[model samples]
Target: MDSMKNKIKLLAVTHHDKKNINPIRPEASQIIGLHRSGEVDVLVLCNPGSILIPYFEKEGIEVLTDPLEKKLSISTVLNIRKLIKNRDVDVLHLFNNIACSNGATAAIGTRCKVIAYRGQTGNVSRWDPSCYLVMLHPRLNKIICVAKAVENDLRKYLWGDKSRATTVYKGHDQSWYQNESADLSDLPIHDDSFKISLVANLRPRKGLHVLMDALALMPEGINIDVLLVGADSNNEKIKEMIQRSTIPKRVHAMGYREDAPEVAAASDVIILPTTKREGLCRAVLEANSYGVPAIVSDTGGNAELVENGISGIVVEPGNPKELADAIVQLYKDRAQCKEFGVNAKRRAVTKFNVEQGVDATIKIYKELTK
Candidate 1:
């Protein structure tokens, strides 16, 4: 083991809905980006349900799938073990808790280091029992939480051992925003009307209800059209919420789109009314990258991104009145919006680009190897 090459081969495995895989999370993109840049060798093992196989294969990264049913499958575990042994993988990075639990168990004989990545660190009740259970494994060296808020929550609710934790902020495409020649006509909305866009899934955690309530309370003089971009996942509650809303005409529930920056560009102000405990949200950075001001709720990393009244507005999570007030304030003051937008973009360019994130992650990996 001491004489082994320093070159790292990382295995990122996720079990999400197939259609939702590509358009949804930034994990796959991050891994592929790193692999393409020759930073590391990534072998993606997604749920058999995901179509990410072709995408990963296209990028020249080895892709594998497991027929792991909802319940634990012994075959799946064995197959993963075989893959790890064949590739001589240096680290096994699990994107979700289920995979982490399985990977921990699989690494028992091989003594391979395991790292788990958590996107959100909510309350104890929100945590998967598998994550807590995986901590029992000695091979599991670290858990990467996307934000400091999540790291705090993990120490408070789940794991008290802070030594095994690390925080890594998700990066965005900074150059896309800086490239003035990039075209945005491909985005769904190109109209000149006052546009307010929400780039989140139509899930309860995202606080779409709060956003709707705020829209209802918006000032009478403000004429704003909203584009709520996200997948429904057949959630009846969200469906009913969208159906029951009176602002259907004003709000276009255009489902998920890969070109999120394009949608951000078509908007005047981006809104993220998340009530759930989020880690570092990429949407905020992406929104800020396009020089679009945001009115985010005071949840997770929202406060960290929005510089109060300077770059953007941060209101109480799930507070419709406060959200409405902030939105109206920005609406009435276009100059303030422009000022905040400029600052937001500057912040994104300087701090949250993909290259910076990759550099930080590689540094961590190198340190871990040493």
Candidate 2:
């Protein structure tokens, strides 16, 4: 461990503006731990309007505000370079595609080690010039992957030294998930029905339509309902699909609730049917932490969090029949659902502990600083 006599200086840039900060809470645990370690002096650069400013400032870390919108902004690069020179920063940690590109460019000719974060799969292509500026950039000292699957995808296109990419899951603690479930009485869902949740922003890749397809295929009187709890869940596509589905009344689309976790926690099981490019699906992690089994599509790292027939079920993406069958399997056997929930909760505790992620991060920082 580095002594108080010498502390590593860390400068991080990220795009948190207009994005929900709740998803970044796990990263907050890592950041706060690094600053409080007495071995790292941390400074963050984010958008002026970002809620992350107040959250980090509350913990006494310095935060600078800049829109940081463009990838090749000379002013942004020079501004970052100035901060590095003034503070003698030892490392630059980037949390977004633009940040990774700009931060790496800004650190040019400097001794500062660059660390870029990769949260999703795909998009790192050798043919793409922007890819060279982002993940394929040679200036990056390290790429912190959110999952092993992300690292695997990265190595397929990244240039020399595959070891430069590392897996460091943005882990969570069960304590953070231990909260009172939201009272769902207002919803049309019955008390005795087996509740299911699919918590994601209704992006086309999220496969909300596929989920609706599965609901339509469900046999009559399945006694199960789905809770759609994310932004745009009530979008036109979803609305049209719900109207066509047999279980239209059973599907309650609660668009973007602040109490999403509480609502999801109230479910017997959760589903993540996203088609592709997922990186450790935070929804699945959240559900597992909530002690609710997840039935996730086998895309990206969804399977990493679930063991088939153990913690939860893993079905192929866009396969409504398989998904419907899995849901029915869990619903028909409450004992099996309870068993899977126990395993899922245990898996979250054993594999996704936030302190372990922090420890690995600090170790990496120490190595680079040393």
Candidate 3:
């Protein structure tokens, strides 16, 4: 235990700007809090031109910009050398692919420990494969997989050092669920009708189209509104898909929102109809914490978070009719929804709270340093 007093300095590396990025805010806050509380000394490394560099600096955390971006250099080796010399960072904690590549390089020459976080089940495309990443950094002391499915994928695809891989279920802000009562009118979809929400990036993997198909196939007229929340319209594929869908006026496309808990509280059901490949989604936990049961795809870690016919209903991935039937079934049975919602809250409190996640991370750090 005395070794824990070494007071190791940590460098959190990510692709997005820590200060202004909404999705990464929870992770940034938790890591910063861990540092502020004397568990670790922390620094942040991100793209040079990020908007939130000053924000991280204001929080008393040192910020490092990718020198390559600033100098307009293409040589990664020189850039990494510059980073090591400038930051004098002791350990590298990577979040994104770019961060892992650069930070891993810096760690090699220096006496810095490398810990990479693989938050998703797989890469967005072949260009960003997580398994390939594990192959790139053999000395990565730990690889934090958000789901068991992700861990399995890493084992099969990358065949990474199994001894180093650890599954830490994504955590959520518990205090957001504790109070419970809040205004629903300001929410994206707040009609007196039953509201269902699917909080995910407007991407194919999210399977929003399948949800829309399911909603359209419902036999009886159900008074319900579906709220879809996310950003990243770079592809505009989702926008095109939504425009072509023949669903009624009940389905709402609400863009990126920072107040996710409030949005979850306003909705009656949380739906995650992923096509395939997902980490333990934080949105489902957020919704479940607010006593909103989820209708999630059974793939990846969705089943791990949601107990079938217990906390939430699990439908086959990409099955629109099955998803629709499950939604309609839950809608018809208010008693079941309430029961599942209560159980969901209990599960979230027990397994997915931020404190528990931070504690688990701290324990891992202690074990490593020991």
lDDT of 1 by residue, 3-61 (tens): 22446777777777756442344666667777876657778888877766767788888
Candidate 3: segments with Cα more than 4 A from true spot = 1-5, 17-22, 48-59, 67-90, 124-135, 176-192, 200-202, 231-246
User: What is the C-alpha lDDT profile of model 3 across 1-370, one tens digit per residue?
Assistant: 6744467667776666434354565576567666666777777767787655766787888876664332123465466556656666556677766666656655666766677777666553334545344433655777777877877766654433575778776667666556553355544443467888887666688898888788768766667877777733444765655554455466666676677666777778899999887888877887888898999998888999999899999999999989989888888898999999999999988887777777777777777766
Name the better of 1 and 2 by lDDT.
2
Each prediction's TM-score versus the true structure: 0.82, 0.95, 0.81
Candidate number with greatest lDDT: 2
What Cα-based lDDT does every candidate model obtain? 0.72, 0.85, 0.72
Per residue, candidate 2 scores C-alpha lDDT tens digits across 16-56 of: 65567668877777787788777788999987887777778
Candidate 1 residue 253 Cα shift, in angstroms, is 3.2
By TM-score, the best candidate is: 2
Give me candidate 2's TM-score against the actual structure: 0.95
lDDT of 2 at 355: 74
State the displacement of the C-alpha of residue 41, model 2, in Å, after optimal TM-score superposition.
1.8
